[model samples]
Target chain A: MEVDRTDGRTPNQLRPLACSRRILHRAHGSASWSQGDTKVLVAVYGPKAGTKKNENPEKACIEVVWKPKTGQIGKPEREFEMILKRTLQSICVLTVNPNTTTSVIVQVVHDDGALLPCAINAACAALVDAGIPMKHLAVAIFCCLAESGYVILDPTKLEEQKMKAFVYLVFPNSILSVLPEVSSTMKGEPMEHGIITSVTHGAMSENDYFLCLERGRAASAKLSDFLRRSLQSKVPGDSSKAG
Target chain B: MLMEAKPSTSPATFVDKIVVPGDVVLDLSTFTNETIKLGGGLRQDRDAISVMKAGKLKFSKPNKYWVESSQRRYVPCMEETVLGIVVDCKADNFLVDIKGPAIAFLPVLAFEGGTRRNIPKFEVGALVYVRVVKANPGMNPELSCTDAYGKAGEFGLLKDGYMFETSTGLSRMLLSSPTCPLLEELGKQLSFEIAVGLNGRVWVNADSPSTVVVVSNAIMNSESLSGVQQKIMVEKLLQRIK
Candidate 1:
């Protein structure tokens, strides 16, 4: 059975995604990512001198500051910041810049739906723009589970309010490794199928949550391809005499 | 018998190609006898070498590989010449900001022919050309104003000039061999003294402040322009300056 979204999107169709890097001038790295009506602007600074107190000084630290479109930061914003920080920490090569603290400041331009996923995407792009060392790039996607047992890839604000549950899932980018026949799979699943972070809202059965994860993982591959293409297309000075 | 197994994937295929983090770039199983030096963005993961940043894979002959990318922030590396702004002057060292993760310490005695009695006085916020001596993790990098032989070889303070920041890639382009077209075109008409630091800082000086401004702006604008575009842009700027 096909699920019809309010925006006329099919169950598997995601909202259009747009990303631009190096958008902020003064920041070491910056990017703005938007999905449909939701947009997030991220500025990356530091690997600065030292980590914050309580943070282990032996390894690099990640600090995320979330600014909503309006109002002061509340419980939800704090949760978003924590989730974003941990998600970024996992993908980044923290040991490469030990004792340094990289700050990722996320400013919510708009939050129609899937706000956390958009912010995560923006932060990941900003980190890449800043040239921070990372083990891999991460792709975040939002999945909505309707009461009818159908899952939707990306939802709008109206759809989100009507959904029974929603989940934000982050996955490592599916890499096209140059190695000839080396398997990139773990057990029976591809490595990129492993979830880096998952945030759920409302109540859902274990089976429903796994369904959402499967749908979200499938959508993330497309997002990762777009990310890789955009990054490669705009390499600085590709045609210059620097080569 | 293992040496007879020729690897199908060669590192040469990815040279000058774009690679992102987690992309396996080199299969080390092929080169049993040869040793390869890995640079900034490439890391060894078991027998597979992978990239840790998004950039072009650059290979220099004999066996050196690295990832090159343009960015505002610089990760400090050893023996790199950089222009640093002194943030604070302590009794024995000066804290300098080289656009790196932390402030580097330029020892008071690291200068040429330096002695405890003749320590150079550098005011806070002074710009000096220095070389990174040590860049170990978990420690503030150390800087020296003198070269390896303890001589002040163009390593000192600038009397008067205009200093500007650029992407590290642009500064590298300015210092590339066969002098980039933009610099060549500017030099044909104008005379300017320029110092390029690997940490994305450039200093230019000319007889007139106007020339300094022109040279700096030209260099900054030429970062995204092609070689021919750079030549054309310089011509246009020189015309405007006149």
Candidate 2:
């Protein structure tokens, strides 16, 4: 299943992205995000103490609710929730908001495919909007190998069907922080290894696995840049020091 | 010591010296000198003395000057009538975005006096007439839809309507318009109070029965005025009715 990714973009190229904070008036923090045609609105509430007895008391509990258009909770929504919860928990400094729950609610008003990764990005933006303390912002990128052996980055719905496997690239801050520091000082060191998190190959060959990992790393790096820029504009001031 | 009397050219100068405790005198001889020498004070240049007068001059207390600018006051404040939306409702209050400088809190207790189904009766996106019971800086604005008139009485209440975005200054103009005859013709004019929050939230509500109609008409006709200008006109109009 060969897929011709739009714009002749390589498997490492990310889609155009836009993010806005305080998109809604009621929520503590709200953000609207769009990656290609996948648009999602995420609202973050709390750091307010949770009511349920099982709610965590030592660290902030993250609950993600994904709503798709015209249906109840489905498999795709659940999968995105799990992935987003895991990815976000790793980056967020939950201890800062102890005994409270930070809920990330993502409403997929429009789905043009590739919803999970979009939801993850939207949730990250919402968390930032809510002013949550995080060690680093988490960014997710999707990659897949086409039937023709070409890997695609940020696959659309139509392209997803033609792919054998999809990988979600999760990049932490070390990769970005190291790139600028190393490029200026070292002569031979590779500028790419800083990608701390990459989930690839639910099913794929060893060769394809490595290829997907490389693609994931490259794509995640690009998304990290995009997320930084997006968060910068919404926060009204330099948020780099937030970490 | 007697000082030369100065002619009043600028109102500010006359008022400024009036506040000082002294008998201000004017001398014609100082006019030719381009400078005046005072008995108990330093010699002042010609520009400092506006004019010269003769004889013993009597000084009086300076009148307080009230500087009025074109700016309208419409930010949301406590106990002021306001128009807002139910962006979100909590157990005790609703978050309202007033068209002024900040968000104001309208507690459920503020509405307790009015006839409404119950607390938290409003839903998201519902527009209602509310009063600003409290406002905190950099905090979520709370609003109360229930007032003496009840849940935005038929004419006074606005559930679904077009929200015209304009500056707080302009909204004041529309509300303060003195020349607007519609208010007087309607009779029993509405009493309204406005609070312009520092966060750019504007809250307006009318206490009189005719307030809704008059406000709507004034706002509708205010399309020609810009935001700040409209507020001025409205403020003037509202003042005349009161």
Candidate 3:
């Protein structure tokens, strides 16, 4: 019972990934990330002045604004913004810049599949570019479950529509540290194995969800490595040397 | 894996190397007899000295270490000299934008040998070279127009100069000792007065506007170029200008 993908790829294959940083000169930090045809551009501004109303003035506040490919922002955009903001807040060192607000604006450049995951990755790169104090970087990936209990690593837009369920997962990038045995763990899993954020669509069995998570976690390692290498290569002084 | 492999335990080996956040640059177990000073973009967690941002790890002789990163925005730090524009004049302070998180407060009495009767009159949007006296969290930074010795020195109103903004990394490069290649090359031929602020603002004054434009543009473009590249770039610009 094999499911054929229109692109004629294996069930575990993902589309090519492309990322570029500092595309917008005016924004404090900006990045554009594309996974196949899906593209998202994110700009980070501030830690400026004060926080919004109802936010504690003692801690830095994160605000997110999501812009769709066309038209005004609606319910789905709002939900995306909230999820992005919370995911970002968990990674940043907020107390370092108290009584301030850091705004992350995500602009949808294109929609194919795994758009949210692409945006999250773009946002993470932009934050790093901005020199915002963060504990670590997060890598995001998307996985879908097929009818035959097969899990696909990354699905195209058409495949997404045909899938029974899909999930977006964010995980912390694994670290290669100098200190021995500093690896943190949650329960029995290593720290990087812990999920930072997860979003699901449609109903799926518990086993299917766990299977998606397992596949997604595996894919995130490769994504995070790519993210790390791309960022390191573009570092100001290093790039000139490499070139 | 080889690209990200940091030096094993010696902090000295990490000096002048690129480091990312969460990378432990210093393992204090070996430094039990030494006291190393920590600067921006680095923090001590337990016995490990960890980086707080992605940047080149810089080390100064005797005991100083910090992370150097180029960025568009400026974060306020104590005792950093910067160029600021007066945004508003208040009773005891002048609100200035130093390209930081909040508007910095320049005390009205911060000038050299100033008093209530002789407070210098400054119009809105006037540029001033000042030093940050206080940069505390949860509050606007405080700036002073005089040095720590209460002397004006080079801190005062910057008059009749064309000011532009660049990245903080570029400004730092311009202010580094032994001089930067781009500035050194430009100065060999053109006579100009330049003020570099750590906040990424650059003010250039020359005999003519064309000279100012050439010098400023050269400095801006030199950010990503190596020393040899900067020298070559400057030579080409000078030839074109001539």
lDDT of 3 by residue, A1-243 (tens): 476999887877778887888888799998888888898999999869899999989989999999899998899889888889899999888889999998999999999988888999999988988999988889999989877778997788998888888888999887656555643344667667888999998888999999888888888888877777767764432311110
Please state the error at residue A160 of candidate 1 in Å. Answer: 0.3
Off by over 4 Å in 3: A182-188, A235-243, B1-9
- Docking quality tier of model 1: medium
In model 1, pairs of residues that clash are none
Off by over 4 Å in 2: A1-3, A6-8, A51-53, A173-202, A234-243, B1-242
Model 1 chain A: ten consecutive residues of lowest lDDT = A234-243
Task: Provide the lDDT at A164 for model 3.
Answer: 88
DockQ for every model, please: 0.73, 0.02, 0.64
Q: Which candidate should be chosen as best, given DockQ against the real structure?
A: 1
Looking at candidate 1, what is the lDDT of residue A109? 96
Taking the tens digit of each residue's C-alpha lDDT, what string does model 3 give over B47-164?
A: 7788878888899888999999988999999999999999999999999999999999999999888898888888999999999999999889999999999999999999997999
Q: What is the iRMSD in Å for candidate 1? A: 1.2
Worst 10 residues of 1 chain B by lDDT: B1-10
Most accurate candidate by TM-score = 1
Full ranking by lDDT: 1, 3, 2
TM-score of 2: 0.48
> What order do you get sorting by TM-score, best first?
1, 3, 2
Residue-level lDDT tens digits of model 2 in B1-242: 13233333223343323111111223233246443233211112222321111011123343222211111123344555566666767666666655433445566556544434555466777666666555443344455555545554321336333344433323444355473343333333455543322222334455654665566567545533444655567667778767
TM-score of chain B of each: 0.94, 0.43, 0.95
